[model samples]
Target: MDRPSSPAAPAAQNPVQLYGSFHLGEFELALPIDALQEVVTFPDAIARMPLAPAHLLGMFTLRGLLIPIVHLGSFLGLPNGTDHSEARIAVIASGDMRLGVLFDRTGEILRVSTGQIVPLRHGSESLGLIESAFHLGQRILQVLSADVLSRLPGLPHVLNPDLAQQASQRRMAQGSRHQAISFQVGGRPMALPMEAIHEIVRFPVLEHSVLADSRCRGWLQLRGRPVPVVDFASFLGLESCSTEAADGSDSEDLRRVMVLRRDDSYLGLLVDEVDSIVAYLGAQLLPMPAIRGQAGLFAGCISRCDTGAHDLILVSAPALLAEPYMAELAKGHHDLYLVADDELRDVETTRQRARETWVTFHLDRLMGLRIEQLCEVIDYDPTLVRPPGAPSHVRGVLNLRQTLITVIDLRSLYSMKEAEDLAASKILIVEHGGYKYGLVVDAVQNIVNIERAEKLRVPAMVANQLDTELRQDLREIVDLPDQTTIMLLDSVPLMQRLTGNGGGSTVVAALPERVVGQA
Candidate 1:
């Protein structure tokens, strides 16, 4: 038998290559880091595709596009494992085609020089799927070619150009759309314009008051002011949908109070439950049919579901506030709570000035950027256009409408591990110097109002560990009572650094070349 020839030594100038390794049964496999987008947990739901090959697991939605998943073990003719509950899906991209392959678990990233790789000899049976092999300690790691995997027989191709066009159409329609906070009252679905809602809180213990009645349930102390709570169903002359038993034992697990504020007055509408926030096009709203009594309270009716079978009553805040009883209640609340508490009013005035809203997201840890600095938070668009000679941290440029926005990967910039779940990632769009840029983050956590006094300077110990670029952009740290600390990033300085106006280092040398009619 002839022995295999030893691999030749690579030139001294050969750069180290990064490979993302994963396990398939007993075999260890890897792919070039650039080809891999991200790894995500196995989806709980998958839509079966008709007439697909046996190796095709099914299709699942990532972000907004449908991605076809493949069973790597089945395609490789390996025996099926008894358990796969902990399986992960590795997303790989080649040109406009994306594919997901199942793996038992993921391993560490392997940094190997060109000299360590052994080229595959002629007559190998891999059919170009396995590019080459390299030994890592006692185990041999087979490198897979992404282009070959994407073009494998019977694998469905995901055309991103079509998806991009669909996204563009959605963006064009956004101008005529409005967001509403959907909820349930009197066992019926309803919604209010999101801007009219101050906040949603749980059903707090009420204090008995002279204002207690069928319409006015009671009053609750919120912050330092008294807010009159009204039984919204009773006010609308509808049946109660409360889950409380007739015996009077409270069962208010799902009940919520939607607080509405106008100037110094506050009112709470007790509802059965708080549903989801929805965005609907203006054309979807239809005029309300003439019904008896309180029908005028609704500005219009809109379809809550895609099939248009379920309608949601769109409450008009102006009409609700204009009611005689609502006006009286507002006056009573102001006279009883605001006028008498002179000291409390002074304290609230100071507090209001110090309150600031911040949009929080996850990176290596919890972090925030001021809400005013953000244009919007959107799902990560995977169909990005890569221009020649772009920077390492610049993921790519995405054509949002007709404008090209450069995407900066925060993980790459901060030297953190690549995000594992691209489907769950978000991009914070920010404008600086009349240009829009998208900052990629792991996930968006919440929108919070933090007091200015709560923000503290970054401790010396923590600041010393951060990179000089990152440390300079660190504005303040907020520590919540629950032991969660959030590091706030100063958007101005960060944007300045990226635009090469602040600090000597430049993140992106230039904006990516715009593609005509790309979207």
Candidate 2:
């Protein structure tokens, strides 16, 4: 939809301003880049507020901040036919007012000049919402001011003094609370403290072991070690609801195995579907109701109000491990597998040897960088200052903790398509030759430990197609047991190549004098 445009001539002298544009109903809108926070995928759950305005869709927690979401089309009286499932939330902040506006989809980051923007007349039909308009080929781009939206009548005071104080106090109270991984077993809700879990993995093919019995399902290989898998519902004296195949294997698609850890020993608890991670204060849990045959296993019962739907039985890991039956199983496993002290030593030695920690991230495919090479990972900052005469790979200079770090887009360097939406992108801070640079990646996955033996050299066929620099950077690949392959990034050679010291031509040039001097 085109707004009434007062066409203005583009001037070379005008400063370029960045705007994060998005689609709302039939109208295209843009906000000053600095006023916008990161865009986020639509949250699964939004806590509905009682007696709130109709336009207020509800609120959700984003990185500890309670942001109230509003339906932009509903507030502006536009016909928004966009599906809620595919919508994205654009978080914007002005002074103390922070809000998330639901939009149909995100548009490109527009670099418009000041001379091209035609200021809207005050008290127009948009009611100060439309601050300016600019031409984009055959269409017009209406710029919305976050300050005006924040001050609009009938909007919720999300960061009001009273609410902020309450939020602060709530955060303080939550800081002392414990988090638990919630799951379902035999149609009943259960949870184990986060500290008790080593990792949660999808159900894998089980190999028959001596430990298999009424409670023990079978043994599953985890990192070259056999971890005894226990049917959680059977262990808790509850009949399993999962159906079995003709081959006597579990047929449920949602089955997950939670690997419980105690020092060097591991046990897997098979459950149906892993749910959300929840935090609860001690006082929120009611005392465990006495149940025959399952005594001392539950720490407390979390009410349905705290968790959704059915009350959750919080399992005490120490008590579960200390049970007579469970103790016998552990002892039997140790006796059968590791009877000798030398065998135990060998197992520990094998686990510790050549274990390299790598931070996995997504690009065109799964990729990794040595954790030691990275200083830290942080969210992508949109307020980067684009330096003049810089290479396309050099995104901009970001002021991080008083240091001007040059942010580089790895996609540009690799000659891949640039990411359209950077809502979920992360910047990996790396230091090389005393200079810190931020590498923008699609998304940062969890850190994983890869053994040297697990690393496979890149096939010669694959290496020959790539230019020498990329080929050297991705010389090895790690194939995990889960069928996921990760290309290991040789940071030393990559840094050297980027900094123009390697044998091959560099993808990145030397940092601009201004950026180098500031750093």
Candidate 3:
């Protein structure tokens, strides 16, 4: 398997953070809210700073206050775009410095939770006055610190030389988490870049009755409105809690609701509680090993925090949103923030991003599998059953259109659990060695375009969880944050684990042997 070339970056500072990731032409930006103030309509607040530096685009007056507006685009070497339907004057403030950063348009507001952020790399060369960044979907957002942000990127220098050099070194570093929030899955924590979370919510009722289907359901009420709830855990191959954490810690409090944007919808993820939106400037978080012959989706892991128990999961939710079915639904639900890629060609860009990345999912609950290992995605056809006593993972057989397919309960095979937090599920059909089997998955997440030089960060115990034969195929790990390591999973070995010699022993053996008996 190939490795990702891009290594993890460091955590962002001040207000601008990762989950704050948002689109701007071909570029994306995610910073802290503290880095920004209110955004007013462009023309309405076009007040220039009186005799301010040229780096300063000018001042804009808003609500009677004279605020200086800077051209963030021009600073970033992009074409000046002032013609926007709803132009906005982004008022940004960091410490003693304050500037109204100008934007072509006010993109969506990202609510990065504790787990989505990673730190920036230390000793980076591309620093150029920008410190860290957050990745959202297919885009990356560069973050600017208070002093570092005095000027925008790609523009001529104006700040003091000494300060600039420090910022640059801080960037392009060999070490740093890059994003602010990250999480752990299967024991490995990936950075989630904070700008992505909208609001963090905690609800005691999140733990729902364990339903049989890949789907898990719970109710979400917001501002007096009742919205349809979907299971997010199952979507990401995570196990849902039957009840709250053992400590009972505020699981029932429903303290915070993390609202995130996925294409056309705002996702509200329920968290146990909110942790610090801390900066992660430790080591570069690395991607999981490449195993399934596809570009892997997981970016990298974030080590345990000061609390040491609940780490964050930094990830690209839109990648999971792209599966054909959910993509259609997101188109409507996330209507307000949708881009006009009405031309399906834009999707090609996403495919291009896939150069060699792959992602993991479960066919049934508990099974960890990758979509690349599968041939195509299909629906479960109960009417297609054929024989008895096959693998329990094998959900019998199904006839789709004109193809004879065998249904495999990958979820059951991989041991993936359902998240009662958010939405739907998907099924993938994989083929190899002349045998074609359809595997059920909760949802198709993002396709990772893993770079060759990626780093691996995970807990030591989890690294021990990697199948012995599987460890050799992993990318590589320099320094594990909090001493955590993530060993990427491959399909062939997983297949053996699901149905092979000497593998059907543990509880996981239930699906394969059961299929043999029930078929």
Q: What is the C-alpha lDDT of each candidate?
A: 0.73, 0.72, 0.44
Task: State the lDDT of candidate 2 residue by residue for 40-141, as single tens digits.
Answer: 667889988888776677888764568888776654556645358768788888997788888876654455657557676541223467788776544567
Query: Candidates' TM-scores?
Result: 0.46, 0.45, 0.31
For residue 483, what is the lDDT in candidate 3? 46
Find the candidate with the highest lDDT and give its number. Answer: 1
Q: For candidate 2, what is the TM-score? A: 0.45
Q: Which lDDT value does model 3 have at 99?
A: 62
What are the per-residue Cα lDDT tens digits for candidate 3 across 299-365?
4455444324344455654454454433443343334333443333355344434433344444331
Superposition TM-score, candidate 3 onto the true structure: 0.31
Per-prediction CA RMSD (Å): 21.8, 18.4, 25.6
Please identify model 2 stretches exceeding 4 Å from their true place.
1-179, 193-202, 220-226, 237-254, 261-266, 281-283, 306-308, 339-519
Where is the poorest 10-residue window by lDDT in model 1? 1-10
Backbone clashes in model 1:
0
lDDT of 1 by residue, 1-519 (tens): 011122122223334566767778767898877687666667778888788877787888764567788776664557766466777777888998878888876654455657557555322223466777765543567898888888877876745677767855775674466666677888888988765665566676787768778888888876566788899998888886464633457632667777776656778898876554445667778898766767578989876455333577899877777677876786687677654445764676576569777778998889999766776567888998777777777888886645677888888887888888788899998877667788999998876778999999999999999987789888589987788899999889888878877766667665443421122
- Ranked candidates, highest lDDT first: 1, 2, 3
